[model samples]
Target: MSNTVVNSAGAGLVRAVPALVGAAGFALVYLVSGSISSAFASSPAPQPNVSGEETRAWLIENATASAVQAVLMLVSVAFLALFVGAVAAITRSADGPARRWAIAAGTAAVASMIISAVLSLLVGGLAAGLTPDAVVALRTANFIAGGTAHVALFGLFALAASRIPGMSRPVRIFAIVVAVIAVGSLASLAIYYASILILAGRLLGMVWCVFAAISLARRLKQFPPA
Candidate 1:
């Protein structure tokens, strides 16, 4: 209702728009790149426990697709960074705990995106030149960093956002659920079968961001932040 809140809300809405576009962009990139990689690859896609030879072969065959995926992933990370900033701005007017949650969310989001971006760079720029064992090691690290760690930290962000006041009940609950799934993805490290949890959590988290962004935008328009 105050001028500060109004300005923060306005800025948040502006940043939230990128979350929507980033989500869509990531999804499209995955679909297109996944298809291309699958089509070009002689071997199956690399798994968490993939063999060195298999990963090297896949990397060699799909260098172009991997590069494309990496470039787009970096772009997605930038958008995600913007979204985190947006959430922080929107919560700028909140009380102590809420503001702290926003800060935590921002931190977790940044960490997640950074890990993912680094993995993307490794895959895009360095995979081809590495030895088989090194490829396997790096690829495994990338999988853990980009998949399990990324989603789990992102879940922390969602959990933090869920604690913020004024989000719709459904959105809050959804965020909590997404966070649980994402954080739970850590189990994948121990239970390879649990990798499904990582996939589910990551996909749902992206959707949750878009939903929250839209909800924030609607609230801003309805209340005019003042």
Candidate 2:
């Protein structure tokens, strides 16, 4: 029983650490980016319309913050890889469909995180030095990648978790709720181009991580030590 507790603790860490790191990254993005936008723009704060030179200046001025954000995102994703392992470990006791969905969800999420980190890093480096058109192009890449894959994959994860007969009802039900939110998030992005919706989705996604981690930890507690 002690062994089970210890291993469950480890699995909990595996899930929680990445979500925490990722949360920190998002917080930094909001703080750093929001400040930069306000600093560079006039009243009304339509930052998306701010000039490329201003954007470049902010990137250069806050180079360290930009660097930190990139590092935090990368760190988050790295631990996210461990979270994948945790999910896989849990799936060993789950049915075939649950296992398959879990793997697919993990793969998609890992891919999204990698893409988000790499593109954002590249844009941060290049946007500050490039032409206006070039800056626009870079920003476009930054905007477009995650809607189809990232949140959708999370919805898929929710479905898989709900199907896992081993988990408790509240856990499964919450998974389904989160899946619905994920779908709404995607629809908001697709139909209205609402960036705030995306933000809400991601924020809720982290919350889901916390709850799912707890659920998975409980499941892991039932595992016998090898």
Candidate 3:
């Protein structure tokens, strides 16, 4: 029993690592980007009429911060992918279909991360020195890419959680609902008030991370020692 407890704890810690890292990275990005956006929102500069404009303002305010956030986002995605993979490996017996979904979801997340990273580099560079028009174009591109990637991550997380053996179905369903909100918000980013939707999605995402951490810890408690 002691061995089982120890093994479970180790496994849980390993499984929880990705979610924890992702949550931390997301918080960093949200806080830094949010601060930047709030500063710009108070500025006299004309707001860019694009999706995630407020968030983009923060990225434009500081090139280094933008780069850092982009990298952090990528790292977060990698961890999320790992979390999904771990879930699939651990819960193959409960639902094979869910496991496959988890794998595919992880793949989508990784792809989105890669795309976002490249776009961030391009946009961050352009924002460093450019005319208003050029900045608008770069900002538009960043919004589209970032929004899409975020939606993908949320969707995958929801799907994977639903399939995991020990997770409550209600929690899984809530995750799915959050994913839908995220995807909807992303789709509406071009609209004026869509940022609110995106913001809501991010809030839901944070909640999901908490849930994931708890679920993973519980799973770890059940593992046999290696």
Judged by TM-score relative to the true structure, which candidate is superior, 1 or 2? 1
Two-way lDDT contest, 2 vs 3, winner: 3
Best by lDDT: 1
| Each prediction's number of clashing residue pairs | 0, 0, 1
User: Which should have the higher TM-score, number 2 or number 3?
Assistant: 2
Local accuracy of candidate 2 as per-residue lDDT tens digits, 43-111:
322144467676666655655555555556666556555655565665565557786787788677767
Identify the runs in model 3 with alpha carbons over 4 angstroms from their true place. 1-62, 127-134, 187-190, 220-226
Q: Report, for every candidate in turn, its global Cα lDDT versus the true structure.
A: 0.71, 0.60, 0.61
Instruction: Give the per-residue lDDT digits (tens) of candidate 1, residues 78-104.
Output: 667777766666655554685577567
Model 3, range 53-91, lDDT digits (tens) per residue?
544565566667556557666665665565555555555
**Candidate 2: where is the Cα deviation over 4 Å?**
1-54, 146-148, 188-193, 221-226
Question: Best TM-score goes to which candidate?
Answer: 1
